[model samples]
Target: MYTDQLKRKLIIKKPIQRIVSLVPSQTELLIDLGLEEKVVGITKFCIHPYYLKQNKKIVGGTKNIKINVIKKLNPDIILCNKEENTEEIVAECEKIAPVHVSDIYTLDDCLELIHQYGNLFNCRTEADKITQKINFKLNDFKTFIHNMPKKKVAYFIWRNPWMVAGNNNFINHLLTLNNFDNIYNSKSRYPEIELKKIRLEGDPDFVLLSSEPYPFKEEHAFEIGRFTHHAKTIFVDGEMFSWYGSRLLKAFDYFKKLHNRII
Candidate 1:
């Protein structure tokens, strides 16, 4: 018997052979941990490897999942995340197999998740290697950004409702590590903001438009720049700011380049 990050008790059998990964980042981590063969099912958004969807069964999406398909997969364990998946989905998956839910809000939390995966899947060696690389890159980034001045910014995640990354989330955690002060740090999680409010209260130095969830193009940047006339609007890779897994190995370098470009 074992407990997940959410403190849910699970009876997981060793030598776990089958897996159903509902989160994209976790799916990628599983691959990095050399559990690719064990991953029987993955969501449509798990596109990191670019070839996973072609081989693995597609399980609807992060918000919506095909329960029937998961039931048929007959996975030994179902992997999920606190933010990427909902409580209802976790409850449903529990009926099919032991569910391991990870709740990550910081870099430390992400490292811990990797360690947990190591113990769970008997891949401690692979997990350690990944974490070591992340730490190496992370420390280098820290040294590179140590002297850089902190910049205030508003990170927009959506447009139709005008949502932005707020406090107490992985995005915000990474933003802080990059020395970017989120204008909405006072608010919890992702929050919707009015353009008027952005212009009035959040006088940010930059308006970062994410390249996922909404695909903010150059025209969108220009449109947002018009509203936040004082701030520079730039399209940033959502994966770098949000994806908290093996991708972080590349994300630190991306952040360094982004800072240099913006500077």
Candidate 2:
């Protein structure tokens, strides 16, 4: 039996077999760890591995999960993320089954989460291989971009509200690792900034628009280009920069490609 801070008692008489994933990244991680048969329920956003879309049952979004549907599925375990999911959803799911909440903001957090998941799923060997692969790839990217000039960059996640990734975020960490300076390093986490202020002082060398939380297109680039004439604007994969689970295995190759385009 396992008890969390909320005093949610988890009676794990046996290893978790029927698992439901509220978070997309963790769903992908389960697949990567060869637990595809165990993952019975997953969010619609868990689109990676392609086969999951055709095979797994859809539970709902991280924020708006169908509790009734989840109850019906009778999952032995549920996987979630702290930032991507809401506290209410986690609490609700805890009442039904053992819910493992992953709180990741840095590379270390990601590695720890991977190891934790490995322990929970009895896939320690696979987890080690995945971790080694991610480390090797990230190091390769770091080496490839080590000599490049560190240009200041602003990574946008939303529009209308206009949010930018700041220090302590996974994206910001990746940017720093890739030798890019995040202009909003003073600010902690993601912050909403007015376009007027961005024009006046937030003059970053590069503007990267993400494809999740808000889908930024070529038109947005042209729109932002009007204000920051000197900055190079490009669309970035939000999953590569934000997804902290098994998706990271493929992110290094993506980052390398992006770096090549920039240099």
Candidate 3:
């Protein structure tokens, strides 16, 4: 008997050889944990390790899964995330195989997810190595950021309707870790707001445009800069801030560079 982050029970076979990963971060983590060969299915968004799309079965996307494709893969287990995937997806996956859903917010939650994957995939050593590297970088980042002045930021994830990273999410958690106070922290999840209203809240110190989710380009920075002329509009790597897994091993270093750039 195996338990998932959602406390769901699953009967997994020993020497687990087949896997279906719904989350991009976890897909990358699975590969880093030395389960590359075991991954039989991956979402179209699972672009990490670049060549993954070439070898693995494409299972549609995080929200819209191709059930027929997953069935063909015949994976031993399926992995999903609370934020990236939906309840409907979980229910659908349950019909085919056991589903493990992970809900991550803080760094602790990320560590727990890695530890859980370690236990589930029988890759405790590789998992531990990844976690240790992340922790080491985390500690180093803490020291690096200790002397830096905290800046209030508006971290934008999307445009058009214009959604910004809000409270209780991984991006906001990472912002907090980087000592960047999120101006929209009071809002729930990803909140859509009017551009004109940004000035009313008192222009933030920075307007960070994320690379993913919306693919905010240099032009978007200039557009956002027009709204909050006082704020410095900068483009940030969404993966470094948003990805929770072995990716954290590289995130701390990115944070240091980001902080220095801002300073």
After superposing candidate 3 on the true structure, give the runs of residues whose Cα lies further than 4 Å from its correct spot: none
lDDT string, candidate 1, 63-119, tens digits: 899999999999999999998999999999999999999999999989999998998
The runs of at least 3 residues in candidate 2 whose Cα sits more than 4 Å from the true structure, single-residue gaps closed, are: 1-11
Please, what are the lDDT tens digits per residue for candidate 2 over residues 105-184? 77878888788777778999999999999898878877888788988888999988889988877888888887888888
TM-score of 3: 0.97
**Which residue pairs in candidate 3 have backbone atoms (N, alpha carbon, C) closer than 3 angstroms, thus clashing?**
none
Local accuracy by lDDT, each model: 0.91, 0.84, 0.91
lDDT string, candidate 3, 1-263, tens digits? 87877787888766678999999999999999999999999999999999999998999999999998998888788999999999999999989888899999999999999999999988899889988898989999999999888898999999899999999999999999899989899999999988888877757999999998899888888888888858998889999989999889888988888888878
TM-score against truth, every candidate: 0.97, 0.93, 0.97
Error of 2 at 68 (Å): 0.7
Give residue 52's error in model 2 in angstroms.
1.2
Q: Every model's Cα RMSD, please?
A: 1.0, 2.2, 1.0
Window of ten residues with lowest summed lDDT in model 3: 6-15
| Predicted structure 1: lDDT | 0.91
